[model samples]
Target: MTLDPQRLLRDLFDTAIAAAHPRQVLADQLPADRSGRAIVIGAGKAAAAMAQAIEEAWEGELSGLVVTRYGHGADCTRIEVVEAAHPVPDDAGERVARRVLELVSNLEESDRVIFLLSGGGSSLLALPAEGISLSDKQAINKALLRSGAHIGEMNCVRKHLSAIKGGRLAKACWPATVYTYAISDVPGDQATVIASGPTVADPTTSAQALEILARYGIEIPENVRAWLNDPRSETVKPGDPCLSRSHFQLIARPQQSLDAAAHRVRAAGLTPLILGDLEGEAREVAKVHAGIARQIALHGQPIEPPCVILSGGETTVTVRGNGRGGRNAEFLLGLTEALNGLPGVYALAGDTDGIDGSEDNAGALMTPDSLERAAACGVSAAERLADNDGYGFFAALDDLIVTGPTRTNVNDFRAILVLERHTDDH
Candidate 1:
């Protein structure tokens, strides 16, 4: 049987996504019956779907609100689904986040609040802290995206700047039992980093947020800086009474998704080497993958040929140019350049949620001849990479993978298929 590397790689991505779908993993994680009201609140790319999952599985009276990216809403009867901007907060998210805080406030001890947290939740639940405006928060978020800051660093700052994040939401729930079911996106699945840890105790400090901003050279507005410096803006810490009653569970994570993909690869009679949910700048991560692929092809050191290298985790791209593409595209572009059309090697990098950066495509694919084909089409891979135009480069080759919102996110899914090295001997 002829092996279609592209198909295999894509299949692995699908397996990874399917493993994290809310319907598949959430129902089992829900809490049992509570005497008081059951209120569900959440924000993220997967918020709406998770709310729907709870509505389907729990046969109790439940009502609440959840904010998801504009196009990623799922049908829920009791819980209200609010569409909002992501990767950056908007007024819509602010409005809904306020309502979420109000709903859980002054609740009784018997009341239960199920918070469906996921990636993008930090922006989705955008409630600026006192003295900070939405515009201020937006500006800082945009700067962080372009500043090449990692998710942890960005969230560390976001937690300090927000009113509802960094365990404040759980604090608002007060005496109510807060049950947080999160779909992990950040590396290591740190509960506090996922959506800024709306329901979990935040160990990150305001001083740390200030240091991250300084380290990234991100200029902060006067008021925002003052708020970060204020001791009152600190998040709920471990052993805090507000979060004492809250129980957090990571229902889905990047490593689990990678394992699912690896299972599929093994079923295909191919050895799978998981790179362990790598995290770094996109271009740097791509170079690392390329180095590994080259090693396997040239020396067969890590593993023999006819193997699939799998990795998962989020990677950030510092936009140097007004380019159109997400981090996945940037990674592929870098990988393509490094691979230089090495024979019998193909790869795919995509976000599990089906969107890469702010673009419509999930990600893109690269074959051994990607560079040669791009040149034929009058497209320069290196130039595109310089301009951070991965989407443009791949679009020109009709290689962009366009899967409209998968409604689930486990960060990035990357797979490189390395086949047997070919030798020319006639």
Candidate 2:
């Protein structure tokens, strides 16, 4: 088969995305026995897409509301799709969150609530706990994003501060059963971590959430601190009566997406080495991947050339610089700098959701001559890295991969393709 690095990498990403899409995973996960009337509610980048899938598969009277990030909306006759903010809370999210709680409330034991969840749901369903305000949630959310906290830690704090998350939604169903179908974007694929586990019982506590804030040196609001100290901020815990009727299922996950990408790469005639879902500081993780790629190129310890290294997981950025780049772009920039323009190394890192750190582009691509192209354009690789300007650096070389609103997110997708080494290639 002919080799086109850019096309192959992008195709692999698309294939992985297709594998986790609601259409691919939701139908099989539909309820086998409908013991009650169904009401659907969800919040996330993929909620609208999930709603569409539910409408297409289920044969019943379904009506509900869901919130999704703007531009990710899909037409659903039964499920009303509302656009909201993400990675940060907004008034729109705040209002829709209240409606979701009301919709699930007052249901009988014979009623069932179908909740669709995915990455970005945490921010999309932003309803502050008692004594807290939307602005307060927004402030804490911004701090969490900039504090370099991982998704789990961020959601821990969010669940404690939320009125609907951390199993509160399920609690509202009372004797009714709440069925939660989630697409996992976190490292461990824990049901409790995805979208802050709106319908799943949380084992984490308010005290732990406060501790995470302190660990990250994030400043907590006076009321938020007071609420955290009080028991009212506590999420629904395990063995609670509210959780007995909750049914959680992971229909899609990051590792599954990674495996799907690897399968496609192998089918295309290149050996694929899946590194599994990874997490950490983007640059630090890039350094590790850079070392592995270097080993394969210089010594071939792991495998010979013509192999693609793939991984999926959410990476963090401290946001020290005012650079316009997401974690994936930062990872590629860090990888590029660490590789130092090594021959036969090409890569692409992107969020599966088609948005990277609130940027328009999905992510960026890197080639052996990427640095050279930047140099010719008078963009210093080191300086760009210093400013956390990976997006700018790649944009200068016309290497950004832009795909608008894929509607489904399984977290970060990274590919490092190492071609066969030659003496002259060096």
Candidate 3:
């Protein structure tokens, strides 16, 4: 192929982003104008963009508010967009979350409540339980981040500790027809796991939340501890009457984004082999992918050379040290080490939201000489991997990709390109 590799990669990334752009995917799924007012309330990296989409699409009277991470907000006409701290709760988040919950209250059956949920909403829509201050929630959220807990576990604790999450938001909508349009950021796209299922019934128990806290060695305040220990704090479970009229739809997902990227790769005169949506420890996933890519390059078993292997899903990082890296970076670092100068293999892994685990860099790139570059600089890839300093390694090499707030999130997108070795000419 005569295509410039960098340009081809950029095009594939853009295609993935376009497929998950809230304005494009969510607008088509909104409920048609009925004889009622449409009130939108949501939180996530894409909340503001989703709100903007609703404003542009809905013909009837539309008014609502949404919360998104700082720098992730888009301009909207009617829907008020609030910027909040992410992966941790802050006062800005608390205020906006309260507003969203209160906005849905007092809605009648004639009114329709539209919830635009997406990744990062758990923190964007923070509303600490009674007697639990935002500071407390913030502390716990930070602890969870470093605890190596999966998204599902983190959100379980989030649901029980918040006043607005779980099914409380749906309960606030009362007799209103509550419709939730979510962009899946969690594995399996479970409704209750996305944004802690603010408008959906939570099947998790408060006891389970407590267990997570204990597992992470997180100490809640006396009052907060008591609340979680009590059954009263448990989120509304399945069969709750409050959620009878609640409706949910998954508008965008990691798989769709991956497929979009794969399509673009194939269009660029390359084959596309998609790895199924995967999750777990970032380094382990990277090792597995490296093996597969090596196989493709040598044996061409699973896939032929001159192809790109694409995958998407969220990955977790077990923070063993105070490293300035996210899971995606960690994965790239591990992959680089595993490849060990394997020729003609290039890879890119990035979180679709433009941020990876609270870091500025979206992710890192790996080239065939990645290990050589590290060795030349006296950097031990093994040492960095052990310290969870993936970002530091890439930053030293200037190989980090920083895209600054894509305004949408569909979890992580990974691509490993294997090129065939050229034959020597006579």
Winner by lDDT: 1
In candidate 2, residue 310 scores what lDDT?
92
Model 3 earns a TM-score of 0.95
Q: Give the clashing residue pairs of candidate 3, or none.
A: none
lDDT of 1 at 402: 89
Task: Give per-model TM-scores.
Answer: 0.98, 0.98, 0.95
The total of clashing pairs for model 3 equals 0
lDDT of each: 0.91, 0.90, 0.86
Residue-level error in angstroms, candidate 1, position 157: 0.5
Clashes of each: 0, 0, 0
lDDT of 3 at 387: 93
Residue-level lDDT tens digits of model 3 in 11-80: 6777888899987798778776643568889899999889888887888887899999998999998899
Runs of candidate 1 with Cα error greater than 4 angstroms are: 34-37, 423-426
Q: Against the true structure, candidate 2 has what lDDT?
A: 0.90
